[model samples]
Target chain A: MKLNIALLPGDGIGPDVVVQAVKSLQAVADAFGHTFHFEEALVGAIAIDKTGDPLPEETLAVCKKSDAVLFGAIGDPKYDNDPKAKVRPEQGLLKLRKSLGLFTNIRPIKAYPTLIEKSPLKKDIISGTDFTIYRELTGGIYFGEKKISEDGTIASDLCEYSEAEIERIAHLAFKATRSRKNKLTLVDKANVLETSRLWRRVVTTIGKSYPDVELDFLFVDNAAMQIILNPSQFDVILTENMFGDIISDEGSVIGGSIGLLASASVGSDIAMFEPIHGSYPQAKGKDIANPVASILSAAMLLEHFNLKEEAETIQYAVEKSLEKGVVTPDLDKNSTYGTNKVGDFIADFILHAE
Target chain B: MKLNIALLPGDGIGPDVVVQAVKSLQAVADAFGHTFHFEEALVGAIAIDKTGDPLPEETLAVCKKSDAVLFGAIGDPKYDNDPKAKVRPEQGLLKLRKSLGLFTNIRPIKAYPTLIEKSPLKKDIISGTDFTIYRELTGGIYFGEKKISEDGTIASDLCEYSEAEIERIAHLAFKATRSRKNKLTLVDKANVLETSRLWRRVVTTIGKSYPDVELDFLFVDNAAMQIILNPSQFDVILTENMFGDIISDEGSVIGGSIGLLASASVGSDIAMFEPIHGSYPQAKGKDIANPVASILSAAMLLEHFNLKEEAETIQYAVEKSLEKGVVTPDLDKNSTYGTNKVGDFIADFILHAE
Candidate 1:
């Protein structure tokens, strides 16, 4: 098989980590007797400097032509703290999601047994916790009608959700549930918000088609509490964009480190994979940012192509890397290994794993 | 001082808990040599059953005449599971907030040293965690325009915020901060929501007036993660309505049990105090419900009325009760104390402490 992959190593440590993901993907391709064509493109702050646009037209074109896109982190502290700036780095990623019609974001939260002690939660509470969150990315408050008064005293953001938007994501999440533990929990504030009520109605309506999957509804407030109280009870969680943003990050705490989580944003014809962590401007060029999230994202990309065995090999390599302490300082503070070294260790383990 | 307090013991274990809170309040009044007048009103499911309106006009009238209102829990599981019902017990609480203009809700999350082990989080992670959350209670998506399409295919809710609304609560929170740690963290989705941007602008503008108080901003997403990662870093959290509903519950995790939390909703002329937990319908008449939250709420009511020493006495007694293992099952599972018994212990301690 042949795959055309677009690589967007946006800014900061993005380029350094993408290099590792690319090397690991190359190893996966070699072992599986496949060919992967990688096309590199610019995005985020660096693109803004060179092309005057954070997401250049050329980048979008390459992403459109590729089978899948592998993304490194975006943003810089220079752009982050300056609220008065006209152009921002995050706008690029938001635009990419809208242009690509990438509506569904899947973030899997799983606690690793070996790293349980790293969690703020007791081991008994966080262990055996496995759940996937499906967030609607292209709609809701993120893309709503926003207005600031001429006097600048008042501001408003409209949170609107069309039934079609809810239905599409509900269907995708329902299907995802069929393959998992067959339990789906819809997290919303239906008791308070009209949009939430609509979501409940649509998802509950769509639920009839998937009789095998058990369904439950939790108010977003209670859901936030339950996520910490009894994370093991949830299998798949479906929610709107804003709630998703908060809960997915909260979900990262279950793993004890946001640096280890990766996500896949899937649309009809195009999909993109990236680490759940942000661009750490401090770690730029330091070779200390964790690359396992990006490397694991590459594993997800393989699984996207129905190469389950290849994906499992990458996952096993990640586990082995953690066990052997071949990780960045974030994962093993006492270790002397750097980002590239950890990536090299995982890639080599992937190549040699039985 | 002469005080007129309205007591609304809504449903389930509401009456039992309110009874304890009232007893504690009586002890405070006697200790402080204050005259007190008490009026009891009906609300929630019980109100609906008798007057056909969950929040009857008479109940509202009594609350208006009172200096402060004390509320027990509301709602029933019967109404919770039935979505088809038009009127709910919650509507009564919502109506009360709107009518009374209780725009700011203050919930203090404090970890008790004796009860730290009950938390799912490690003791080291949750110990010494003390923060107060000020949630704009009357506006945002909760009161926004909700529309359902004729075909029931689309649902939308408009999240609108005016500068005045944000200003009032920001001031309240800022004032509270001055009395405590002199730090305030405004939680919003400024990166995405127009309403959040409005919030950020207004709060920042207000922040400039208080040079003594250090102010910071956190995206709602990052705030959720930080609440667990480093809860001690937060002193006072000010957020809009919906975000508050979610984050406060998440903050409750640090305190080990939601049953131990209390809240105060204040306006210029009127204030309301209540335990943050809802009616535990299952524990109704079982004598197992925790009354500490309610009793503590009564203590807060005393403080609101300028009875500082009286409030301190009640707080000290509640702490001593916890120290002596004279708590409800929620706080001490091995203890066989009943709801009335816990109230008696607190009341006795308050009298003896004086």
Candidate 2:
């Protein structure tokens, strides 16, 4: 099999960690007898500095023509502090998603056995916790019509949803449930919001097609509590833009380290995988950032193409690294491994580990 | 001082726990030598059964004439399970808030020294966690105009905010900080939503009036993670109704049991205090429901009327009860104390404790 992958190592530690992910992918290609072509593209702060746009036209073109896109982190402290800045780095990723028609953002949250002690939650609560969040990325309040009164006293944002928007994500989430735990929990404020009621109505209709999966509902507020109290109860959580933004971030805490979380954003034809952590500007060129999330993101990209064995190999390698204490300082302060060393170890494991 | 208190013990265990709160309030009146008059009103499922209205007209009138309202829980499993129930028991509370002009919902989440073992989060993560959430109750997406398309496919809810709505809650939250750790964190999605940006702008302007209190900001998503990561860092969290609904419930996890959480809804001239937990129909007549939340709410009611010493007395007694293991089954499985027994202990402690 041959795959053309567009690589956007955007800003700060993005380049450092992304290089490690490339090494792992290269190792997979060699070990599994597959052909993988990589094309580098500019995005985020670096793109802004070079071409005055956070996402250069060539970068979007590169991504559009590729089989898959592997994204690194975006954002910089310089661009972050300035509220008055006309162009921001975040808008680049947002534009990339919109331009690529990426509608579904998938995040998998799991408690790694070796890192259970690092979690804020007790072992009993966070243990056996494995859940995937299917968040609608493109629609809802964030992209809705925004307005302010002439007097600058009243402001509003419309949280609108169409059947098409709900249907696409509902199908994805239901499919996910069949592949994993056969349980899907739809999180919404249906009793209050018409949009939520629409979500419930649409998702319920879609659930009829997947009779093997059990579907249930929870209000956003109660869902927030249940996530903390008993995270293991959830399998695949489906929600809209805002609720997903809050609960997924809340769910991230169960894994103990933000550096180990990976996310995938997909449209009809294109899917992009990236680390959930921000580009730590201060860690630039330090060789100290964690590369596991980036490497795991590479695994997600493989799974997107239905390369299950290849994805599992990468995941197993990551787990082995944690067990062997070949981790960055964030996961183990006594460890001497840096970003490059961690990537090398995972790649080495992929090639030789039995 | 003389006071007229309206007591609304609506349904299920609502009457059971509310009677416990009344016990503490009566204990305070006796010890503090204050004249008090109590009037019971019908609301929620019971109100629907007796008067065919969730919030009876007479009940609203009683609440209006009172100095303060001490409310119990609402909702019944029968109403909760039936989607076709036109008059939900929950509507009673919503109508009550709208009628009384209760614009701010205040919830204080604290990790009690003795109850730290009960929390799902590790002791280090939850200990010393003391923060207050001031949620704007009446405005934002919950009350905003909701629309369903003619064909019933598209739906929308407008998340609108006025400077007046933000100002009232901001003032209450800022004033709260002066008495707290002198830090105020305004949670909003300013970068995305127009309403959130308006919130930031209005709250930033309001922060100038309270220079003694330090003010900062956090995006709602980040705030959700921070609440679980490092809850002690926050002093006061002020947010819109929807964000508040989510995070406040998330914050409740740090204190361990929802049965111990209390909330107060306040307007310009009137305030109502209630336990945050819902009425448990199974525990309606079982005498097993935890009464600490209801008793703590009575403490908030006293504090609302400038009866600080009375409030402290109730708080101290409740803490003593927990310390002595005089708790319901939720907090301590080995404890044999029931709801009434626990309330008696707290009332006795209020009257006798040094």
Candidate 3:
């Protein structure tokens, strides 16, 4: 099979980590007898510096024409601390999602057995905690109508959702549930927000069609508590954009490090895979930021294309790297291995794996 | 001073808990040289059964005329499970909050030295985790314009915030920081929600007035993570209604149990105190529910009225009760004390204290 991949190594440690993802992807392509072509594009602060547009149209074009886009990370401290700046790095990523029709963000929070002890939570609470969050990416308040009054005294964001919008993501989540534990928990604020009520109504209606999947609803507040109290109770969590954003990050803490999680933004035809971690601006040139998340994102990209064997090989390599302690300083601060070394180790593991 | 306190012992464990709070309040009044008048009112499922209105006019009148209100738990399994039921118990609580103009909800999360071991998080993470959350009670999506399209295909809740709305609570939170460590973290979804941007602007503008207090803004998602990752970093958390609801519940996990936390919803004149825990309908008739939260709430009420020594006495009594293993089954299943017994023990401790 031939795949066209657009590579967006946005800013800071993005370039460093994307290098590892590409290396791992190359190993997968070589081992699986597949042809994978890559095209490079700029986004975020880098794009803004070069082209004066955070999301250059040329970058969007490359993503549109590709089979899958492999994203590194976005954001820079300069853009982050400067609230007065009109153009920001995050806007580029949000725009990319909107432009590419990547509406469903799947963040799988699976705690690795080797790293369970690293979690701040008790081993019993953190162990066997595996769940995926299906976050509705395009709709809700993220893209809602934003207004600032002339006097700047009032600001409002409209949280709107169409029935169709809720239905599309709910269907994907339910399907994922059938393939896993067949349990779906829809997290929403149905008691207060009409959008949440709409989400609950649509998801419940769609749930009837998938009888094998058990469905439960929780108010967002209770859901947040339950995530920390009993994470094992969830299998597939479905929520709107804003709730999903908060819940997914909370889920990241369960894994011990946000640097270890990978995400996939999927639409009907195209999907984009990336690490859940942000660009570590301080570690940009230090060669010490973790690249495992980016490499694992490449694994997710392969799985997205139904290349199960290739994806498993990449995951096995990551596990082997962990077992051998060939990790970046983020995982083991005393370790001598740097970002490139970790990437090289992972790529080598994939190549030599059975 | 003479004070009329409206007591609403709503449902399940409500009566048991309120009894203890009233007893503690009476003790405080006796010790502090104040006259306390108590009035009881029905609410939640019990109110629906008797008056067919959760916040009956009579109940509202009693609350309005009172100097302050002491609220017990609301909601029952019977009403909670029947989502289709029109007159639910939550409505009463929501209506009460709106009617009383209880717009600022103050919830303090602190780990007791005796109960720190109960936390799922590591001791290091939970050790210095003392912070207060100020939740805006009456605005944002909770009271926004909710609409369902005539065809039932679309639903939306407008998340609107005026400058005055955010300014009122932001100022209060800033004042709180002045008394604490003088650091405030404003949690919002400014990157996505227009309301959040408005919130950031208003809070940032207000922050300038309190130059001694260091103010920072965090996305709600990141705030949720940081709450568990490094809870001590926050002094006072200021947020809108819905975000506050979720984050504060998440905050409970760090303290070990929701039953161990208390909250105060304050208006200009009227204030309501309640335990953050929901009514455990299963433990309704059983004597297992913990009364520490209610007892502690009464302590807070004392502090509110400038009865600092009396408040400290209640707190000391609660700590002694926990230290001596005189707690409800929820706190220690191995212990033999019941709810009423625990309350009796604490009250006894307070009265006998030298």
Candidate 4:
């Protein structure tokens, strides 16, 4: 098989981590006897600095012509604190999603046995926790009409969802449930928000077609507590844009380290994979940033293309790395390994390990 | 001091737990030599059942004519699943908050030493966690305009905020910072939502008046993760209505059980107190529901009226009950004590213990 991957190593530790992911992918290609080509493009803060636009026209063109996109972190502290800034780094990623017609984001939260004790949650609580979150990405308040009064004393954002938007994501979520434990939990504030009511109604109608999957609903507030109280109760969680942004980040903690979580955003024509962790600007050049999340994202990209064996090899290598204690300071303060050495171990394991 | 209290023991375990709170309050009144008059009113599902309105004019009148209100839980399972139902038990609470001008909701999340082991979070992560969340209650999306299209194909909810609403809550939260750790964290989605940017702008300007306090900002998604990663790093967290609803509930788990939390909603002229936990219909008549949250809410009511000594007594009595292992089934499954027995123990301690 041949694959052309568009690599967007955005900013800060993104460049560092994406280097490690590419190493693992190169190793996978070598071991699996596949032809792989990688094209690089500038995005986010780096792009903003170079071209004054976070998403450069050339970058979008490259992504559109590629088989898939492998994204790194975006956002810089400078743009984050300036509430009045017109052009921001996050706008780049948001535009990419919209331009590519990416409608759904899937994040799998699984507790690794070796890393369970590192979690803030107790071992017994997160031991067997395994769940996935399907988030609607293209629509909602993020893309809604935003208004500010002429006097600048008032501001508003409209959160709207059409049936088509909800139906597309709801179908993906229900289809995901069948492939998992066959339990789907829709987390929304249906009791209060009109948009949430539409979600509940649409998802409920969709659930009838997948009668084998058990469906349930939880108020977002209650769902927040339930995530901390008992995460094992969930199989697949479906929610709107804003709710999903909050819940999936909350669910990211169950893995003990945000450094180990990966996510995939899918559209009809293209799919993009990225780490759930952020830029971590403080650790940019320190060589202490964890690269497992980016490497796992590469594995997810492989699985997206139906390269199951290649994806599993990368996952198995990552598990072995954790078991052998070859981790960055985030996971183990006493370990001397940095980002490069840890990635080296995984790539080497992929080439030689049975 | 003489005080007139409105009691709205709403539905399900609301009446059951509110009775325990009354027992503790009566004990406080007797021990502290205060004159207290209690008035009962109908609200929530029970009110809808009797008067065909969730918040009847009579209930609002009772609350307005009283010094303060002690609210129990609301909502029934029957109203939860029916998204099409025009009348919901929660409408009672929303109407009551709007009518009474309850704008700011204060919830303090603290990890008690005796109950720390019961928390799902590891001890080191949640051990000394103590923080308060100031949530804007009467504004934002909950009170904003909600609309569904005639064809029911599209739905929207507008989240709007004005300078005055942000200023009032900002002052309250900043004043709170002076009383404890001089740190305040404003949680919002400023990078995306226009309303959040207004919140950041208003709060940042108001923060200059609070020179002694240190103020910072966090995006809601990162805030959710930080709440689990390191809860002790916060002092006072201020956020908009919906973010607060989700965050404060997530923050509730730090104390080991939601059953041990209490909250206060304050306005210009009126203040209401209630347990943060919901009405658990399953435990409604079982005599197995925990009563500590309701009792703590009564203590907050006393504090609202400048009855500091009386409030301390109730808090100390509840602490003593926990320290002595006299708790409901939720906290200690092996304990033989029931809800009524636990309330009796707290009341007995308030009356007799030093």
Candidate 5:
């Protein structure tokens, strides 16, 4: 099989992590007897510095031509601190998602046994926790019509949802649920908001088609508490854009290191994989940042194309690395490996996997 | 001093816990040499059972006539399970908030040392966590306009925040911040939502008035993650209505048990205090429900009245109860004390404090 992948090493530690993910991808390709081609593109703060645009026209063209995009990270301290700045690095990623119609973000939170003790949560409470959050990316109040009065006293945002919007994501969640634990929990404030009520109605009707998947509802407030109290109780969580943003980020803490979580944003035709962590400007040139999240993102990119064995190989290598304590300082302060060494170890493990 | 308080024990363990709060309030009144007058009103499922309305007109009248309202939990399995039911207990609380114009909901989360081991989080991580969430109530999408398409296919809720609304809550949070840690964190999704941008503009301007209080900002998504990762970092959290609802509930876990969390809703003139826990139908009439949250609500009520010494006395007595192992089973699995016994112990302690 031949695959075309786009690499967007945005800014800061983005370049370091992307290099590691590319090496791991190459290793996966070698072990699986597959051919993979990569194209590099400029985005985010680096793009702004080079071309005066966070996402250049050529960068978007390269992404459109690729079968998949592996993103590293986006952000810069310069842009982050200046609230008055009209243009920033994060805009590039948001625009790319909108341009490519990447409307659904999938984040899987799992408590690895080897790292469970590292979690802020007690081992007994977090051991069995594993769930994925399917967050609607492009709709809801976040993108709704916003208005401010002439005097700047009143501001309003309209949170609108159509049957089509809810159905598109509901199908993904319900189908995924059928394959996993056969349970789908929709998190919304249905008791209050019209959009949430619509979510319930649409998801409930859609669930009838997938009889094997059990469907349930939880208010967002209760869902937030439950994520901390009993994360294992959830299998697949479906929520609107804003609720999804909050809940999925909250889920990121379940595994202890935000640096270790990878996310995938996909739509009907396009998919993008990236580490959820931000680009640490302080660690940009140090080569000490963790590369596991980047490597796992490569795995998610493979799984997006039905390459389950290849994906599992990458996952296994990561687990083995953690078990052997071959990690960066973020996970183990005493470990001697830097970002590149950790990447090298994982690639070597992946290539040797049976 | 003379005080007129309204007591609304909605359903299930609501009555049980409210009884304990009343007892504690009486103890505070005696210690502070104050005359307290109590009036009772019906709301929630119980009110629906007798009056066919959740928040009856007379009930609102009673709350209006009071200096403050002390509320217990509200909800029953009968209403929760039946989604198609037109009348529900939560509607009563929502209506009561709207009727009384209670626009600010304040929830304080403290990691009590005696109960640190009971938390799902590692003790070291949560031991020093203490913060309050000032949630803008009676606005945002919850009370926004709702519309459903004639074809039952589309729905939308408008999330509007006036500068007046933002300023009202921001002032409260900023003022409180000065008296506390002199640090205020405004949580919003400014990059995405128009309402959030308005919030930032209004709050930033308001921050100028309180030069002693340091102000910072956090996106709702990052705020949720930070709550779990480093809750101790927050001093006072101010947020819009819906974000507040989700974040505040998420904050409840920092302290361990939802049964020990209490909240206060205050507007320009009226304030209502209630436990953050729901009415547990299973524990009704069993005398096993935890009453600490309700007792703490009474403590918050005293604090709201500028009776700082009286509030601290109640807080001190409650701490003494936890130290003496006088809590119900929720805090201690080996404990034999019932809800009433625990309430009596705290009240007894409060009345005898030097």
Candidate 6:
């Protein structure tokens, strides 16, 4: 297969990590006998600095023409602290998501056995924690109409969901359930909130077509506790934008290191994979930040294209790297390797996969 | 001191636990030389079964006449599984909160030294974790206007908050800062939701009055992660209704045992104390349910009345019981003590406390 992949190495440690991801991908392409082309585009704060536009017109054009996007972290402390700034790095990413039609975000949290003891959670409890969270990106409370009174005393955000919006994501989650564990837990507060009720109603109706999948529901509050108490109970966790935003972050803690998680934001037309961590401005040129999340993200990008064997190859390499302790300071403060060296080790492992 | 207390043992384990709370309170009364009047009221599923109303007029009257109300868990599987049932136990509790004007709910999560290993989290991460969550009980999406379109194609819940709502809870949490670590973390989705932005704006302004209490903010997503990652960093966490519900439950996991959590709901006129766990219908009448939460709730009730010494007496007794292994099956399966025996041990300790 031939593909054009757009690399958005936005800012800070993003460039460093994306380099690792690119190296791993290049190694994967060589091993799998696939033709691949990489096109670089400036985005986020770098784009903001160079062209005075966070999402340059040329950058969007390049992304639109590519087969998929491999997004690195975005955000600068300057932009973060300046809430009044009109043009920001995050806006650029949001616009790209909208333009690319990336409606759903898939975050897969797997507690690696080697790293389970590193987690704040007990090793016995979260050792086998493996679940994916399906969060709707384009709809629900985040994109809802926001209003405040003139006196700034009254403020409101409308959490709305249409049948179509619920059905699309529900189908994706239910269909994915068939490939993994048959249990799908829909987290919502249906007993009180109207939107949650609509979610329950829509998801239940869509669930009928997939007789093989066992459907269950939990109020968001209870789901929050369940995530910590027995995360192994869940397989595919489907929730709305706001609940997803919170629950997925909560899920991040189970893996012990946020640096070990990767995510895929996909729609019908285009898919983008990225690390779940943010741009740590302080770690920019330090060569100390973890590159595993980005490498795993590259692996997710492969899985998105139905390159299962290639994806598994990368995953196995990552596991072996972890097992061998060929890691950065984030995982081991006394480790010998830096960001680039770890990336090299992963690429080397991929090139010589069993 | 003299006080009148109302006991609402709603359903199932509710009765079993409240008996323990009452025993502890009676011990406190004996230890402190305080005159106490006690009243009992029916509520929840039992109320629904007997009176066809979840919140009967007499129950509300008894609560109103008391200085403070002690609430046990509510909810029955029969009412839970039957969605078609109009009168439910939860509705009774909701009505009580409404009629009593219980505007702010305070849940304190504390990891007991002896029980820290029971937590899913590592001992070092959550060893000294202790924080209180102040969740606005009467407002936000739960009480907001809810709607389903005529064709049922769209559903929405308006998450609205006024300056008054935020102010009342802010004052309570800020006041609490004086007794705690003097740090307050406001959890909201300010970067996305209008209500959260409004919260940030209001909290920022109100923070000026609390110059001594270090004020910080976290997006709800980050807050969720932070609770599991670094729970000790928080002192007083103030949030809206829904965020509070979810985050507090997540906080419960750090304590290792959900049955150890106690909560209080207060307004200008009245206050209610309860164990955070729900009625375990399966454990109903088995005398095997953990009674520590209820005993701790009774301690909070004393704290509400400014009986600090009295409250600590019960707390110390409960702690001693845990230390001596005089617990129910939930905390230690090998323990011979039942719910009533644990309550007896705690009460005996209070009676003999120096």
User: What does the lDDT read for residue B273 in candidate 6?
Assistant: 95
Q: Candidate 5 regions off by >4 Å?
A: A82-86, B78-86
DockQ-derived CAPRI band for the predicted complex in model 1: high
DockQ of 1: 0.81
Reference-based TM-score, model 2: 0.98
lDDT of 3 by residue, B1-354 (tens): 788989998998988898988887777676667788999998999999999888899999999999889999999877788868888998899899888888899999998878888898888888888899999988888788888899988887777889888888898899988868999999998766778888988888888899999999998988989988888888999999889999998998887866878889988788999998888888886888888899888887776776778889998988898899898888888989998888888887777783
- Per-residue lDDT tens digits for candidate 2, residues A95-152, read 9999999999999999999999999999999999999999999999999999999999
User: What digit string (tens of lDDT, one per residue) describes model 1 on residues A87-182?
Assistant: 888889988987898999999898888888899888888889989999999888888888888998777777788988998889989998876899
What DockQ does model 4 achieve? 0.86
Clashing pairs in 1: none
Docking class of 3: high
Q: Which residue pairs show collisions in model 2?
A: none
- DockQ values for all predictions? 0.81, 0.92, 0.82, 0.86, 0.86, 0.88
- Native contacts present in candidate 3, fraction: 0.90
Mind giving the per-residue lDDT tens digits that candidate 5 earns over A1-354? Answer: 799999998998999999999998999889999999999999999999899899999999999999999998899988889979789999999899999999899998999888888888888888899899999999988888889889888889999999999999999888777657999999999988999999999999998899888899999999998999988999999999989989998899978877889999999876999999989989996979999898999998998898988999999999999999999999989989999999999999998875
Question: What C-alpha lDDT does candidate 1 achieve relative to the native structure?
Answer: 0.89
Per-residue CA lDDT of candidate 3, range A1-354, in tens? 899999999998999999999999998888878899999999999998899889999999999999999998999888789979889988899889878889999999987888877887877888889899999988888778888789877777778999999998999999988767999999998867888888888888899999999999998889988888888889999999989988998989977967879999998878999998888898897898899999989998998888988998999999888888899887877899999999999998888874
TM-score of the second chain in candidate 4: 0.94
Q: After superposition, how far is residue A160 of candidate 4 from its true place, in Å?
A: 1.0
Among the numbered candidates, top TM-score falls to 2
In CAPRI terms, model 6 is classed as: high
Candidate 2, residue A125: lDDT = 93
Shift of residue A158 alpha carbon in model 2, Å: 0.3
True contacts kept of each: 0.87, 0.94, 0.90, 0.92, 0.92, 0.96
Q: What's the TM-score of every candidate structure?
A: 0.97, 0.98, 0.96, 0.93, 0.96, 0.97
Quality of candidate 5's docking, in CAPRI categories? high
Instruction: Put down candidate 1 lDDT per residue, B1-354, tens digits, no spaces.
Output: 999999999999998899999989888778778888899999998888889888999999999999999999899877778879778898899899888999999998988887888888888888889899999988888888888788877677878899999999999899888768999999998877889988988899999999889999999989998988888889999999999999998998767877778899987679999999889899998999999899989988987777878988988888888888888888877999999998999898888787
- Please state the error at residue A336 of candidate 6 in Å: 1.5
lDDT of 4 at A100: 95
lDDT of 5 by residue, B43-128 (tens): 99999889999899999999999999999878877878996989988999988988888999999999999989888888888978
Clashing residue pairs in candidate 6 are A120-B121, A120-B122, A121-B121, A122-B120
Worst 10 residues of 2 chain B by lDDT: B249-258
